[model samples]
Target: MQPLDKSVYGPFQLYYDHALEMWCKDPANAGKQMSLHSVPQMVSYAFQKAFTPAKILPGFKSTGIYPMDRNIFPDHKFMPTYSADRPAPIPNRDEPASDSDSERRHTATTSPAPSKLDTFTSLKEIRPFPKAPARTEGPKKRKAVMSAILTSTPEKLSSQTVTISAAGPSKPKKLHYDADDDEGSQQCSGKTFGWNK
Candidate 1:
């Protein structure tokens, strides 16, 4: 059944909106702009015209509300409640129970509790993992080895002590090439290779 307001049934409203939109796009009303009052009337008329009693009558009959048939519900629905015509068979408390049922009931009552392994052990009771071994000084890198090699050979290097400035390494001078002067280039190229050459 349709709700009082379309917005109250959020999921149904989506399908309803789509159906309304398709109905509005008919060739008869190609470029029509619907007024607020006309829109609701159009929706109601469309729903009434589309969903006739023939389509809806089957739903009421299937639910068994119109004919008032109690048999439509499964056996489970009548399990809790009993009819007065047939009184429920009372168990004979005086008679001795069968061996199988007695054994089953005895085992059910005396079932073993959960094993110690299955039960939860607290973190506080469990022993903590052994502490990680202490970290020692690692071997020197390649740069350190190269520096040590250069400094160790005192005889190879000049005795003159080099002074390091706080300004860091000096920038190299840029060479200006003059195409007109071939002689200057030859001199410069010779010096680059070695003064002896």
Candidate 2:
């Protein structure tokens, strides 16, 4: 192994190196090196500057939880951030999770997370996720979102279906199939192709 060059990190490295070189050359302490505390502090002081805070975060003065001097990120940087309790599923709020589901979830949550040691060599080494079944008609078309101001009166449960509409509500529009209106617009006066009025 080769020794690191003191001036490798540009002018800042050279600047730090110059100070150390001066200290080492000082006749008062010719043999002694800087202490652990002093060395780390010196290194940090050389690199760490005033513009360290990450976020502006309106109304909040401090950028982070702790002060700049207080070492929030210690020597051992990253701690495992996996949650002990997994978050609830965001989908299907209308239907509550059953007891069986809760039990399954509990078992799933209790399973130990794949450790850092779990390494794979090839595609065949790892378990594969189930592939989705193929559909013949390609992808389905997206439906429009329903209007907010719609008021539905279920005449018959089968007849009354929520149609996705962008307009403010379903108005009582008279079916005009064959005749033309006063404004010369072809208003087709005929029955709508549905089960109800």
Candidate 3:
């Protein structure tokens, strides 16, 4: 949907301005001569000119979803006024949430406006869509070569097994197996994202 004009949207104009400030600062936009410090109406102007729904929604040549995940207002940036059912913050790979995580929630009732600019940044509460389902799969992978070993054995039959694991970063694409005479030479290779990627 087309965003409403800055004058019509009330205080939320501050929120869009914060987004524009970020968009114009991206290095990819260098030399574009855009600035967050532009005229008051510029954010809505840019929103009309730039945030086409087609660019985010799926369609031909579409960039797919442009997620505006609710940001917790720790500083002077604009943020969505999320509901009490707000989704949990995704923990960073190496950073588990601390005990104070719950203490830091900046509810509209408790939100602070430390500067005059903060007044322009306040946004009305918005209902967000339900969060997507969580992924259930883990990262470990296993390959079995027992059948090949059984068939390629030389002379009298002998028990042989080959196990290859690619749990983390895989390099060199091809892994060679030096099978003994009974097992015969075997090669197995592939790339795995491990569970982390």
Q: Specify the highest-TM-score model's number.
A: 1
lDDT of 1 by residue, 4-102 (tens): 232233433554676567767877767877667667765665565545565455555655656666577687766645444576688779878999989
What lDDT would each prediction earn against the true structure? 0.58, 0.51, 0.49
Report the C-alpha displacement of residue 10, candidate 3, in angstroms.
2.9
Q: Looking at model 3, report the run of 10 residues with the lowest lDDT sum.
A: 56-65
Q: Estimate the overall C-alpha local distance difference test score of candidate 1.
A: 0.58
**Candidate 1 at residue 85, lDDT?**
50
Candidate 2 wrong stretches, greater than 4 Å:
1-9, 44-197
Error of 1 at 81 (Å): 21
TM-score of candidate 3 against the unseen true structure: 0.15
Better of 1 and 3 by lDDT: 1
Q: Tell me which of candidates 2 and 3 scores higher on lDDT.
A: 2
After superposition, the stretches of candidate 3 with alpha carbons farther than 4 Å from their true spots are 1-8, 35-197
Residues 122-177, model 2: lDDT tens digits: 75557576789896796878898644533445433323443324344767976656
Q: Would you list the clashing residue pairs of candidate 1?
A: none
lDDT over C-alpha atoms for residue 145 of model 1 = 30
TM-score of each: 0.24, 0.19, 0.15
